[model samples]
Target: MAQRILIAEDNDRVAAFVEALLRHEGYTTERTADGIETLQRIGRSVPDLLLLDLRLPRLHGVDLLKKLRKSPVGNDLPVIIVTGVYRGERYARAAQSLGVRHYLEKPFSANALLAAVKDMLPSCVQVDAAPEEGEPFDRHLYQAFSTGFSGTFHFEGKRKATLSFIAGTPVSLRPGFRHRDFGDYLLQNGRISANEYDYYQGAGHFRSDVLVQLGCLRYPELLQEKLAYLTGELLEAFSGPPLKVEQRSFPLSPGLQLFTLNMPSLFHRGYWRSSAPDTANPFPEEVYGQFVAPAAAFYRHVNFLDLNEEERRFVSQLDGSRTMAACLEGASGITPLLRLLKTFGMLVFAHEPLSVEMPAGMPLRLLFNVLEDETGPGGDGPLESFSDLVNEESRDDEPLLPAEPPPVLPEIGDLSLRVRQVFEGMQGKNYYQIFAMEQGKFSFDQLKTHYFKLTREFGPETMMQLAGEEAGMVEDILATVTTAYNTLSDVIKKERYDELLGSEKVGLGQKGDDIFQAQVQFQSGKVFLDMEEWDNAEKALQDACNIAPKNGDYLAHLAWSIYRNPQHGSSPAMREKVRQTLNRALTLDRVPSAYAFKGWILLEGGQDLLAEAEFSKALKLDARNNLARKGLREITEKREQEKKGLFRRMFS
Candidate 1:
């Protein structure tokens, strides 16, 4: 069925262009010229996809995206964002949180639009086909696609098959089976001795099937023994329903397959064993033997003092015979046991009761505690003990022991009061506000003007002392002020304030011209780029680049605007300029926007593979990037639609 697409563009021309393109692809599209109509149209009948513009009439694109996510139908609906304005990290992060799938900057191609749509579609399947019946399970193939499944299945015949589906897709085919057949297969393969199998059954109390495979008994005798045991206990334990195991196959390797088993619904609620057959082991004794020895060995080697008293007592009480719940009951709580066991990687839960083995020392508990203390209610104080523990553990020459705590700092009453005073005065004001300028939008001249006025009143040394003394304040005043100064002066705090703000404003009045001229030139360059005049853009961008040679965006955009002109579009000089600009931009900040533009240029220059790689790189850097999404989508769709037939070749 043809999918319905909605284009919410504020510009009439852009909307018409998109509508025509989608129509040519046989998709029914709805168009809205503003955000208000876009929301209204979606509310009436949600489209499969939405093409949103960042700047729209009535409501902004960002606000609309938020509203769409909250709406029931729009929550999972894919959206492609289109914008002209340069959205930095803040906007990109917000769009990503709202689940914008693709972004298209100005001058995006039709192929980019189509590519994005195809990538986000529900029907897209990217994995290779599952191995045929009788083929060995492949581990590599299983991990290739991201999937979540829980089920067990039984295969009727000898063949192996593959299974694939997205979330919520109904699966009916049985891919594999679970049975006592493993023992027979092992015996046929000569991996175990019959005497060893008998010893395992007699002493280890292994399952009959396992004993049979180990050569303890013939298959017929093992089957009879299993039947007799089942007659007395299995009927009661499995009485609720026959075990219905569902299977899903995942590619684990080129030829190796791994299967996820979904046992009966009874197992889903965390019940491993039933009450009537309490004496009947929930898992095969052979399974218990495989894990129990290692588990005991691990317990013996573990240092009890390293664990809390509660954990020590819990481990000491665990005997091989006791189940996890029974051990928890004896210990009075399962929390510590579960935590310690899981932390060490010694435990795994499955259809049977939890199993444990001695594993490599994990120290995951210590790591978790450290991370928790750093982020938890007590803040950094909790991390002190964790840090000490780590230090103590790292010393190889000495036996591991608990670390001594650091000495607490003495409280300073008057100094604390002074710190409080500095913080309270500067608390609400950001660095820009401190200097009486708007945040984010300010010229060097405006910044300098504010800086001198404030410093003259406060005196440079006193101001520096205040900022330094209150550096430990939680309000982040020092950082804000430093950032503001860096943005404006392009000089370190010590130097800028000492040379400029240290002097009296009256004395500095005559000195403002040189500062003002530098500021004017810088501001004029920004204005030129915004206005899109190539000559002015080049001149201003060059000046900005020279002043802040490390600034990649300025270099990139200057080169980009220059190349946009038809006269310079194909010039070798233009290409070189753009290459240098892009290289610098990448160096300054390999931000999604920079990569998106670079990818677009590469794509236009017939470097499709390089363009795709760049786009992919951009997406990796910022998943919420609309430009990268558009580029990726364009490439993907074009590849998928590329003709392989003789008719296609002939037409081309």
Candidate 2:
């Protein structure tokens, strides 16, 4: 039972940003683009908090707040004003007068927005109260389908159906539509006469089976009719009057027996067949913003929708060149179809005002100053310090490519003289330390927020804006944060870090450091190598390489392990994979093991001359290397046999 939040903003980007941030924290959210719609949603059901934008289309921010205060439904609702339109002292005073204490200007940091939200809505007000049967049916149905909800959902009220799902996938469901019984189905389709149906109806439970015995219904046709009847029931349940739903975990709760039902098809056909509004929220206000198709990878995930030829054509035309309105012209069922696309995340309406690519980040520095002045002493009443909105550049950072692992971070206060002050603060810190979090204290979502907070503050534009900071120094900070994020964000890598942090065997100065952690993994991989556990060795060694890619020894062992892994069958693809890894190892440094492995691959491929050359290189690097020596021995033996055959043929 998550606490719900309403985002009332006309700007799609801003609303989307706020919605994502809140939902990540386990809050249910709804977005409205105008004052009238916002009030309409509130009158139906009030959210725990309202993130109101100042310049709403149908109603102004002040007017909306004024109406809210007088309304019986939302009078005491908490609010945080998020906007770029209103920022002057007069607006601040006007809002303050109306008891709006939390105000965030546009382009505010995620921290600023979240902090304001957290302060006003201190506790998550969970609503476990099931809606009056008809309500939340559509909402829960969409949620269940989209999220792959697992368990039994008992739908009651006007109709009844029990649905059973495994691992969030529906497998069993009894159709609630009982309008047409088998007899009615048979009579309507002219399979049996009216009098025959009446006689068959009296035959009771196994009427269809009874008909098969008699000449009234053929077996194949009967099967088809039965399927049609049951499928009709399923569709009727989905498309007809809303039902009250009771959810219980599967196996523990009484469930309908397993049925071979294609839930996705049922959902798609049911959703479209029924007249329920295809979307849960108001349509996007970005009219001029052209409609865009979702990327292929994203679309593939929901390809279960299995669009027909017409739907596919409609989607193909949404190539970011034409507005949705323009597409609507002469288009039939485009509204529901478009809404369906958006609801399922198959389309992106990067509307007008702001493109889909970015959020409007207004500076928060000015608002903070304004608030500070307004809060001076007794003037502003019960507020003192408040959230500062983040102002960052609209562009995203380039994908971080793996580079040579940096040096192990030193302990703080034991500083580096050459490093800039900004870089110095983080030089000795772990990922958790960078975000001011204690180990294991935060969720992954919280980790993302922390990572986002640092990245936003140190973004290119913001970093350059800082007095005396150079590009190289900014790069240093960004790299450290990015590396820390990469480690602590991954489950396997994070576990290794935690294990490394806890171990007492670490070097005196290198404890809790990234480079030292890589050393730990490399040693672990070497132990796996001793046992000939190639799979385990590859994983551990790969992790080491990830942490310290420049270490030739680590890379060489990883390549050898990959080559020897039993799971990878000896094929051209496998050989190439091994060689690519060895190439990386050799590029880092001329480790004898790397050359020896390369020689083995060449020998396996019958490239005898090339194998000999590689073996020579290995021997030059390390004469005692057993793999290289063995390879040379095998090559000499083959040549001696060839010489013997030639001499024998000549003498005869």
Candidate 3:
């Protein structure tokens, strides 16, 4: 039988969430909204564990616990305090004295809540990703996707991986640390050939764009394959012998590209390869005659598998006057359901303990399929997992890359000019503006997402794109962003940054056209530009340029508007005037876009050689200059780069 837990919380939402999470982990739970109700329930029906919330409707949680400690019924019951109120050492000490070893603050994660609960009353499976013979890597993936966990998964052993998440979704496999051989993963998996792997290995410096040029690999497909490979690697870590593992809350990196993949769908490849009891008949005749119960709340986090009508009916009838033998007799065509439930370990027989027993032989990748279950209790002996074998060999030899660690990317590592432009523009921007947050909006985690995104992008270690003096400017920009994040993060400093952004709003009736007002106009113009209203952008940017002509960003954007404006004819004369405007803008400040605009005009003028030079200059300043790079690609008759998703485009 699943262990019983009692939830004592006054807040309906908190109570509901905690109850659902505990039930999902295969526990029977009871909820009481007040201390009086809590005592009555605990006394009447003893519980295996209790989740106590301090502030109760009828009686205080602390006082109620005191009464429980004095009584025989409630004494020695394990309790974990899940509180939104009554925090601090005083309250903790009081609870500790009352035999509470666990304390979780409100707004906790599903992982944290489950971890605390599992520590007190572990599930039947005990698949906590340690040395135990558990379901291969699939369970870990299932937990992350199912619970919507957002944090870092860190593990170290013979082989390990570090992954980043956002809102429980896996975004990047490795954000900043190690660089593994993705080609080997592909080659060994038969997605690519040895020749292709060798060629890719030789072209270590080639990026997605150049790979397209060489007709070697398509960037998007390669990224997708790499994601698959990393997913496999992460699974392999847990599939093998014991490894040290630790998890902490961490945000996704903005610089890395995130491609969508249905993570649940990726698990079948690993699950069948895991160690499990082999059975021709998963439900033995002797056990079928006995009573059975749901092994877990398996209904949740199982959308990847659909429920058949008969299967649903069979599950609904598990309450009374039913046995596996009866169900098997009634539903003559439910072999698939039986096998599915068996694979998932979703049913347990009364008084029969289940244990994880590994196959005598070593496991092999892709060796066992769903069909293997039909082969009966003693299927073929397992072979060593193929991917694990190859990966182990690859780590030792690494035929492609030098035995030494791969060198840092010569061009600012992973930091591109596009990334720099995205962050550097927010150098002097206020906390709200930098985060693009509206007035009076704050969540420490939300703020953390924006903060991690910016700081990780402008990391000083990867600022090799800039020279010594220019790099100092990047550092200053990083410092400014750091300061803004710190100020907003602290309750006291939140009142003002180094300077307040009170007068930062534009289009209001403000006094003089100072640099501050020009800044307002500039920001408003950028918003219009993002909205693609060329005329409005022109008018607002014209105001900013008139007030602050030396601001190259302002002048360059105004030139962009002049060129984008439909009223501005596409005649050679108009093009020439826009070209001259960009030249003037570049003289004031050499922003990448001005050179990119000049390059585009030259390209349109059929000055291919001159256009290439301008494009190169734009790239030198900002390698991610889309306009410049696109112009060069057009010159060389190559493919246009794929557009980024709105979030990445706007944020990164």
Candidate 4:
């Protein structure tokens, strides 16, 4: 079966060309003119690969790529960027940041397109061709033989250039076009005349606007001729055949400038070494080149005891020749290997392979299962036996009885069934599907829009009935409706409810025990106080206190509720009791209510001065308190008649 590749390009010509190229390469191609349509097609059935053009009619390429990465289906899909406008280094950097695997500039040959496709598809094979005259040799094929390496290569030809690769992928390319910086450096170092530098920089700019702005060379002819000369010079610097791996020592400190040409083979051979810096080269050794051989060898040889029997059997069939497609054929087992290889970095497609190392001494159980068959039926080895012993011992030491199960009240009966039904219906739908809104991030306004739509669908009466039900599971639905109303009304409690629903744990059922205990404590405390049992009331309040220590209202209520109990002893003792309890309550929070309550107790206990001061303080804090106002009036009288007499006397 051919791999499906989706092409998202607005230009008809480019789309047709890409579709044809992919079809010729044995890929099942699908084309969409814009990002919106492309996304819709992906939702229907996600393609195995995506060939993205950055400049689409509706959505730009970078935006489309970001959207694809954000979606579940398209997140990990391989993307090849095809762009006509070369933004140079800036564009290249952006594409690399997005994890783009391959890039094709405009006017690319069919062969170049095919090479890129081959690089990304692990199952595709490369067909060799001879190098043309003055063309630099391709040394990528020799990468399969070495463990790892990094080095600079000088290309000697009509055009001199330097290339750098990291882990088998080209990271930097230099001396293209006019080599503006390079020409400047040469002039500064006396390698070229000032006149030559000025002429070349100007000439280079005339041919390519970017080069001219960069001030590297003057004329296109000069720049091209210089590049050709530099290419030849670099080629001459390659003392041996194009595909040779040499381990040479640097004159600088060994730690400073160590370089490896092909290093993947070394890792495969278990030649693990710390990659540290040296003085000679600031950059670490680059591990570019083919990794298929080493990856295949590791998969074939490593032992993975952790894998299940089926997984092991799948792995045992991994001979180097079989592609992932072949291995997954006729078996529903390919999904696991696809995930495992991706994790192990052993799965390389058409582009550069990533360098992911398995931790030292880590079991290869997951990796090996996909490569080999299980040993036998009773494969419980020493390690398994030891693990079983440890589990048994831990179990035996655990407490015999488990913690009390949560109260199974009738709060969540048929509501669970209704919620489960809704979940089943919306299983694969986006959140927008439930509310019939377009897919997007959840916003306050969006929440209101959906809330109103749901209200209209379910009807106001049904929604009210649902809200009144004891169904705790319907909290989220209630929250959404509440949020909508609160958005228009600005209600604080409803806003808090909305925040609580957004939390990972839904509903107040988890805290039911705590609430029940607090209720029990308050009820018992009140009952004891009514029965004149002062000590019992205190004990009951203490229990409630344990349940909710931070509640100042509860503490104040407990103090007042126990004040006049007969068991509190005689009047003198009761006076001291009132003072202590009121003092404690006042210390907790000096609210107007607390002060008023204390004033009444003080008045009853014959502390007139203290009582008057407390009432005045309460009234000062809250002018509308009727109790404080009445108390203050009783202590002082009005003088309206006296004022009238004084005014009449003054006039006479």
How much lDDT does candidate 1 score? Answer: 0.49
- On residues 551-587, what C-alpha lDDT tens digit does candidate 4 reach at each position? 5445655666556565654433344345444554554
Predictions in order: lDDT = 0.49, 0.62, 0.58, 0.48
lDDT winner between 1 and 4, please give it: 1
TM-score of each: 0.23, 0.28, 0.26, 0.21
* Candidate 2 residue runs with Cα over 4 Å from true position: 1-132, 136-144, 147-151, 163-175, 178-223, 249-272, 276-282, 287-291, 295-298, 301-310, 320-330, 349-652
Candidate 1 off by > 4 Å:
1-138, 141-515, 522-536, 548-652
Give per-residue CA lDDT, model 2, range 217-247, as digits (tens): 5454355455556555565454344567888
Off by over 4 Å in 4: 1-8, 11-147, 155-161, 165-296, 299-316, 319-652
Error of 3 at 383 (Å): 40
Q: What's the lDDT for candidate 4?
A: 0.48
Model 2 RMSD vs true structure:
30.2
Candidate 1, position 75, lDDT? 78
Best by lDDT: 2
Off by over 4 Å in 3: 1-139, 174-180, 187-214, 227-238, 252-261, 276-303, 306-321, 324-652
Q: What are the per-residue Cα lDDT tens digits for candidate 1 across 156-211?
A: 22222233322312132212121122232233223344455455546745444556
Ranking by TM-score: 2, 3, 1, 4
